[model samples]
Target: MNMKEANKKAVEIILKGQPTLVGIGKALDVIPGMKEDIFLHAGPPITWERMSGPLKGAIIGGLIYEGKATNQAEAEKIAESNGIKFAPCHHHDTVGPMAGVVTPSMPVFIMENKTFGNKSYCTLNEGLGKVLRYGAFSDEVIDRLKWMEKTLAPVLKEGLKIYGGEMNIKNLIAQALLMGDEGHNRNKGGTSLFIREIAPSLIRSSFDRESVAKVIEFIHSNDHFFLNLTMPAAKCIIQAAEGIKGCSILTTMARNGTDFGIRVSSMPDKWFVGKAQDVDGLYFPGYSLKDANPDIGDSVITETAGFGGFAMAAAPAIVQFVGGTPKDAIRMTLEMYEICEGENDTFKIPALNFKGSPTGIDLAKIIETGILPSINTGIAHKDPGIGQVGAGLVKPPRNCFEEAFEEFVNSMEKELSNE
Candidate 1:
């Protein structure tokens, strides 16, 4: 098929996807390629020698969390020892936030694309500041992770069973968008809705009252608690677009602290990478750009699927967190529309008279228009243990799309010559 026809087919599959949160399971059990010695991080793969500090730190924490090491020094040693293998979460049909490490023992949300019969997984959000996803592995971080494993996961798992097998995430996110969630950096609306939907089932579960109360409190306190859910849901939607021959639409846009990468729908295995860019936005009182790491996380999957940054106009309040005015938010959304194939059917932005969100990043459009996708994200400290320094806006390096577009043209020309 030609590029236009291929892109239309791919975008339709993405829009038609209905990702449901089926349940939660240990990383070793539910994630497709998970294994005891395997560690999954965000973005395209990188080795210990090339890994950024935050990515390396998360790997150390994962080793310690999995009992393969006793202390930081030991964990660091084991991580680079080759006995522990590192892979990207995307390789196994999963997604995660900053640093995005998934160890064997960690509990992860399981999302199934009810429309496509595919699945995606993500670890629970650890809240903000000095958490594992940001590469912090202090005593409190490890302790909190233990609590999530022991109490939180089970409660949510049982709650899902009580919720009659699954919860439709598309409907939930659609409602959340109307309620002021852009389904990315700002998810207060989605978290509140999530709690409302699952609380009844959680309360009705056999777990005792105090445990349920703590779980409720934990989720209530963290506005971004719903982020993990959205990441995998987006992944479930976008993964459906893969394997479509001649499609020039982008199936993935991700960053490991060291590299920004993109995958074309027709060439999913070929990663076009560029150096990760520094974020430009608001920081905590004492932190500045010098303290921030290059952009990182699987969270950009939200933008790739057409909601996060693409729907910024819907959440004008996001500026309070990511640093920009309401007009800036709307401007970003308008700019994104130029690079995408079309607007989303499920996620509508009320600020524009309930217009559908711009969805499906089209590589051809990026090449033709020279406009890039912008993402709002949490800022992590350059060093491993400092955690989140702030929140901000970022865009993937232009070289990534430039390289991918170059290949797309070359591939198409080769096909034409042969024909």
Candidate 2:
């Protein structure tokens, strides 16, 4: 089949499936291991050695929260001694931001794309700066995680239950784009829309008024709460296109502290990998370039599938962190359209005159165009123990995609001969 035909088939398959985390886990065939008492943020089973600082910090904080360890040092030793197994959220067909850590006790969002019956999963955004995803593991971070476990998750679960059924992430994402959210790096509009959707159920849930209030406060305070929504949305889209024969669409992109791995639509289940790229962006107070970690996490699947840094025109505020002017952001979004298969009509961008955001990256086009996908990511301190120290812009090395394409061509040749 030709590229257009392959692209169309891939989109059809993706749209046919509903996105769910468990479904993604089943699809990817990996179950993230979680501390029986501690909660994780994303994906199936990970080991401590495979974890980045932020992930490690999140893990240590989780140990303390579970009373499994008394302090960071103790938690570190326990993790090193094989007490914990590191896994990628993507391994479980899930995604997470920054450290992308997930524990059993944490509340995870489950998105089902009803159309295709597939699902995607991710942890809720923990607001910004010094939060767990950024790699800060401290009493304060642990305390916040406790509050989310004890208060926020329960109430949100109750509220969502009352609403009943999967949230329509596609529609929310479309609206968010128009309202000024890139759906990654910047989530202002998406968060507001998410609040509006769950507010009524939240008000009626059996959780006490204070509990509901706290949930509201948390969502309102974290401009990126809707990030959880976008992650599943991307998962929904990417999974929809999986398993298409002869297709070269990228199915996954994730980091495991030490390396970044990718899977393509054509290759179905094989992983193509490279070293994680370093992030170069603005820093929080008391942090600098010296402290940033290389890019990590399965969250890049969102951008690769369309809508993260690729849709930056919708969230120019991202410029402050990732180093780009508003014009550059718009250009980036527009440039992505050149390499993608089509526009995601559901996710419209007002800045682009209400045009749909670019969607479905085409690996062939990327190779032909020589344009690597753009990503906005949090920077972890290089030292595994320092955790997240900043945020910025980076690109996956072109070689990974190039290698996947080469293998895809070889596979195609073999199939042709068999025919």
Best model per lDDT: 1
lDDT of 1 by residue, 1-419 (tens): 67789999988999999999998999999998788889999999899888888888788777877788878889887777797998999999989899999998999999999998999999999899989899898888889999999999999999999999899999989998998899999899999999999999999999999999999999999999999999999999999999787898899988899999999998989899999999998999899999999999999999999999899999987877898999999999999999988888889999999999999899989989989899999999888777899999998899889999999889878987898
- What do the candidate models score in CA lDDT, each in turn? 0.91, 0.72
lDDT of 2 by residue, 120-151 (tens): 67776777766777667777777887787777
Q: Give stretches of model 2 more than 4 Å off.
A: 1-4, 15-47, 383-388
How many pairs of residues collide in model 2? 46
Tell me, by TM-score, which candidate is best. Answer: 1
TM-score of 2: 0.90
lDDT of the structure predicted as candidate 1: 0.91
Clashes of each: 0, 46
Q: What TM value does model 1 have?
A: 0.99
Candidate 1 wrongly placed segments (more than 4 Å): none
Every candidate's CA RMSD:
0.9, 3.4
